[model samples]
Target: MSSLKTKEEGKVTQREILGCLKNCLLLLSD
Candidate 1:
């Protein structure tokens, strides 16, 4: 059960990182 929760958190962190990277790219392009 704990492992499953950790995996979910990790996925969320990855998504957040991707979102930040995309925003950074957009700003740089502008």
Candidate 2:
């Protein structure tokens, strides 16, 4: 159960990072 939770946390962090990166790129492009 702990391992599953850890994996989910990692996925969420990765998604957050990706979202932030996308927003940064959009701002730079504008």
- Find the candidate with the highest TM-score and give its number: 1
Model 2 ranges with Cα > 4 A deviation = none
| lDDT on C-alpha atoms for all candidate structures | 1.00, 1.00
Lowest summed-lDDT stretch of 10 residues in model 2? Answer: 1-10
Model 1 reaches what TM-score against the true structure? Answer: 0.89
Candidate 2 deviates by what RMSD? 0.6
Writing each residue's lDDT as its tens digit, candidate 2 over 1-30 gives 999999999999999999999999999999
In the order shown, the candidates' Cα RMSDs to the true structure are 0.5, 0.6
Q: Where does candidate 1 stray beyond 4 Å?
A: none
